[model samples]
Target: MSTAPHLEAGGLLLIADESLSPALVEQAAPVLAQGGLALCQGPGSPSGPRRLVLFDGKLTPTHAEALRGEPPALLLATRASDGRPSTWEARLLGDLLRGAPLLPAGASRHRLQSVADISAAGGAAARAVTQAGGSRTAAALVADVVHELAANAMWDAPVDSRGQHRYAHRRSEVREVAPEDACELAYAVEEGRMWLEVVDRFGGLRPGPFARALGGWG
Candidate 1:
């Protein structure tokens, strides 16, 4: 059970956590191979840098908090309720595999200065996704997603010159986002999908907590 990532120049690797079902992994691997990257397969062991662990059980934010950006990123796969793989994010994953980010460079960008801006962004996102033939249930989640991400950018992301938290202590204030300290949101709609990206100039997002809280978003 050496669950280290298959780090031998393979582009994308599919591996499973010991707790993840073999059937789920078997069903998902080839289905996601079309991204056209140099994908590979192997049973990566647990605990290491740059590990993409798949599992079937519920995981907590603490799990994500533990990683703390040592690997800088991760992706986890789980079984769908219908006993198949969940491909809801396949489009985004495909885009990532293709080496494009910010969810496509042409995504529309929005500036966030207040809660109203967050709501507007979410509403527009949901509309674009639903109108593109995406699932309404999925579209409904846009608000929650955008809200949390935007809140992070406005509150948790900002720091003073000494890297001390600036707005983190004033969330109750819901302080107006200064022009130079605003969160930037970008999104794009496709035939049956859409991507949302939030960016803050601070560039100090913590991966672990983000992973924990956002794990079940998609």
Candidate 2:
């Protein structure tokens, strides 16, 4: 709903439907302008790179599918009937528009195997973040998030020929992550934001699980 004071100007494009309430637009205008972005209301598509198309209503599955191949980053904003953003919707928009890296430049990346490797990668990322002027709390939070991401990639991602998760039953115990099942960890700090990403080679995340997680069903 509001922009962070320390955010650096970054290129952004917000596309909202004409049906969106003027009140909502008024609330979002300053935040969008503060981020150095342009906002357009209409059905017409705009041209350019680093543009983020923001759907300013409930994003149905069919609508999401239709926009799958569209150019530019797609961010959905689901608002209540009264035109107020839900907590998750607000957070998602804040993260996207806060000038953080979509992909960090000059990031430190590591191929991590085993719990020890996860720890090392997190420590390295924390150091990088702090050296870039991130607060100690931010560094610690980034490190913790990286650790959890790495753990999920290592212990919950392997699939077998029968389509069963190889380590699902053993999630509670620590186990060595084989080199073949290793995950990639990358992190960087830019413009007062710390960016962290974990990549699992299996690419086995399904929509059902993702939806459930998002809905806090687990």
- The C-alpha lDDT values of all candidates are 0.65, 0.61
Model 2 TM-score, 2 decimals: 0.58
TM-score (C-alpha, index-matched) for candidate 1: 0.68
Q: Where does candidate 1 have its weakest 10-residue lDDT segment?
A: 1-10
TM for every model, in the order presented, reads: 0.68, 0.58
Model 2, runs deviating above 4 Å: 1-74, 77-102, 213-218
- lDDT per residue (tens digit) for residues 95-150 in model 1: 66456673755788889988789889988888888777878888888768988999
**Tens digit per residue, CA lDDT, model 2, 1-218:** 12121112233444444345434544555555544344444233333343333345654443333243334245545354655444434444555666554454687889987878888998998888889887899889988999888888888888777878877688767567667888888877766767677888798865544344444432
With a 3 Å backbone cut-off (N, CA, C), the pairs that clash in candidate 2 are none
- Predicted structure 2: lDDT: 0.61
Best by TM-score: 1
